[model samples]
Target: MNTLTINQKNKKNAARIAAFALLIMTIFAGLAFGMIHSNLIVMSDPALTLENLMSQSSKFTIEILAWIVIALMDFVVAVAFFYFFKTTNPQLAKLSAALRILYTLFLSVGIYHLIQIAINLDHTVLSTDIMIHLRSFDVLWSRGLIIFGLHLIVTSLLMFQTYKIPKILSALMLIAGLCYFTVHALYWIAPSIETTTQSIENLLALPMTIGELSFGIWLLVRGSRKPFLNATERFGFNA
Candidate 1:
């Protein structure tokens, strides 16, 4: 029993270090994004001139690519977390690993789209004629949100197994999930609801970002714990 506990402790410690590293990377990426592309403007202008449209589109595409990097970092943190818990809770590990794989792939897809957009942005300006019949921004944003919603749902499910967060936290995550889906639905069902969709979707950024940072900090600085050791036992190293 002592050997097993010590092994688990070692694993937890490794995990905590990894989680901290990922969190640091995530924060740095976010800061870089803010600095590099802070002035990116997304506008649906009345004239929709070719220059105006192409410039706006390019900025939007690049900003999204930056956002994808952030999401990928978050996915990495979650993945490291699963590895941390694998020995003690195989079931939760499996769930978290599954989510990590799915979202990593999904984030890759977003990066691909962002690349395609960036490539075309210079050559394909939104002509008034094109705008009259169709718009691609809505499609791109909606699709990205749907994928993100799915990722959130998966992560929340995996989190449930660990029971580390308050039940309300999970519920809030689910609510964020619903908001994601609802925004997409609105985009599809009533095109005019684009503003509403954008508003609600953007509203979630603050809360979700806070939750991820908080979780990362807790997992890193505190690590694991034992019932008998009291709060200090939180330092019990985990993989």
Candidate 2:
């Protein structure tokens, strides 16, 4: 094949890879955040939380595994996004990927705490200590989300610049990123206003959830529908 044809083929393959990565990330993220984390972890009552964890040990294990899977998927999604968008702006794409990696690293630390808690389940650790560990996990995860929000913001900008994705999806992503950042920032900066902050965060969850799910579905379904040449031709490339 000629050089142009070869490059076109490679672009198509990369788009498919990006799409598949989005789908995988979405599945694992849903399990981690919606199903396992929400159902398993009780943030309100520590005693009930401990009881639930012990009683549902199998489910708890699955929850931890889901978190690990999400973290791994985060890395894959980051790389895929970088590859998909680097043609538009290499530096911004790289920065977004770095932010995503940092988010994954932070989440891994929280998961480590969960692992420690699981180990201590069989031990004689104090209930208060267990509560502390659980709380730490929550805090770390929230902090990680803030970084992930930044990643999303940069990704959204890249999406807006790209013709392959819809502009509406880019707008949704921008809203989601802002909500994530604002809500988490409130949680950290003003703990005294948690009741109000939490309510707002819950409300903002709508946009965040919808935006992410839509973005994933769009990538999986329509990511490769258009050729990348149109975009590349409009935006000059190093090559």
Candidate 3:
């Protein structure tokens, strides 16, 4: 095959890898951060939060594994996209992938604190330290997500410029990026209005999910250019 054909094949393979990884990452993230974290940690009541974690230790262990899977998948998707788009815009692709790697590194560091909590769970006297670590995880993860927002913006720009994907996908991603950037900025900068920012995030969460989720589904459903073939003729075994 020619170099161009080889590159096209590589991109297709990378797209499939990225698509599958993205879906897995999203599912684990929803379980880890959305369900488990929300159920365990209550910022308003740290002692109660610790009690919840102690009581639901099994679930918390699953949450930690889920987060590890998410970070791993993030790396997988990052590497895959770097190859997939290197031909189109090498510099942007590298930068985007780098940002995601940075985010994943930050997230991994945050998850380490949870591991620590698991290690020291039996030490009830260390409630203060345990809760502090939990808070650190949230803060550190949120900081990482700010960089993730930038990654999304750059990825969306690439999508917008590329004719192969739909423009609406890019638009949705842009919106998601803006929402993440703005809400988190509000959380750190204007702590007094956290409730307001959370409300905004809840309202805009659909776009955030729809952008990447739809893109993943689109990647799975897309077929390469091929001649039409009847089902029976293609397989040739069944009646």
Candidate 4:
């Protein structure tokens, strides 16, 4: 095979890996959230404490594993895109790649706090636990979500400019990214918004998740040409 063909194959393989990772992580996150939702409905008092909510994750070990896996998957994707962008379009790569890296770092910290929230929920309710450490968990949760929201927006913008993928896909991603921004703003400002907002945001995740999965699958199952191969040919990889 020629060098170009080899590169194409490598990119396809990378896409497959990213798609599988996204699919699995989406499943795990869905299951975990579903359990949390069920618990939320059954519990009395309505204001779920950090500790109480976390307690519902009966399979803490598995949940933790899933979280770690998903975050790592995101990190891998970010790296892959960085390389791809470096080859394809440096300016776009710099923005999305940076956001992905930031998202991964914040997610790592956020997941840690989530686990802490779970353990505490086992012991106490919101009145007691939510206020623990001056609402540190709440702050972390908000910041993490904000960072992630930015990641989605940045990725969506980058994808919009990409050639191989359909523009509609990126458009939806942009919408989802907007949703994240709205929800995060609400979280930061109102801080006591109804659970409905959370539900709404979670719903957006479904599409966003699909977008990522679809992109990955497209790259793997149906090979895509390098978006700007003509341009690359003229400018070379350095471009």
**Best-first order by TM-score:** 3, 2, 4, 1
Cα lDDT tens digits, model 1, 1-239, are: 67446655655765576567567656655653464333442236434444553657655554666667666665666566665555545675666566556655655554555555455555544445434322444355455566556555654664454434455555565666566756776777787877876787688666645544555565566544422121223455442
Return whichever of 2 and 3 wins on lDDT: 3
**What is the lDDT, from 0 to 100, of the residue 81 in candidate 2?**
77
lDDT tens readout by residue for model 4, 1-239: 76555555555555566566666766766655454434443233445534444554566545556677878877877777665444455676677767777777776786776566555554445545434522453466556667666766776776665546667777776776677667877877775774876787777767645656566666556533443332453444423
Estimated TM-score for each candidate = 0.59, 0.90, 0.90, 0.72
- Which is superior by TM-score, 3 or 4? 3
Clashing pairs in 2: none
Per-residue lDDT of 91-127 in model 2, one digit per residue for the tens? 9989999999999998999999988888888536666
Which one is best on lDDT?
3
Q: Which runs of model 4 end up more than 4 angstroms from their true locations? A: 1-10, 36-58, 117-127, 130-139, 192-196, 199-209, 223-238
| Prediction-by-prediction clash tally | 9, 0, 0, 5
The predictions' CA RMSDs to the true structure, in order, are: 6.1, 2.3, 7.3, 4.4
Measured with C-alpha atoms, the lDDT of residue 211 in candidate 3 is 76
Task: State the TM-score for model 2.
Answer: 0.90
The runs of at least 3 residues in candidate 1 whose Cα sits more than 4 Å from the true structure, single-residue gaps closed, are: 1-3, 10-14, 21-38, 46-75, 87-92, 117-147, 150-154, 157-192, 224-239
lDDT string for model 3 (129-216, tens) is 8878988897888888888888888888867754467778878888887777777777778989989988988998898778777877
Q: What is the lDDT of residue 44 in candidate 4?
A: 39
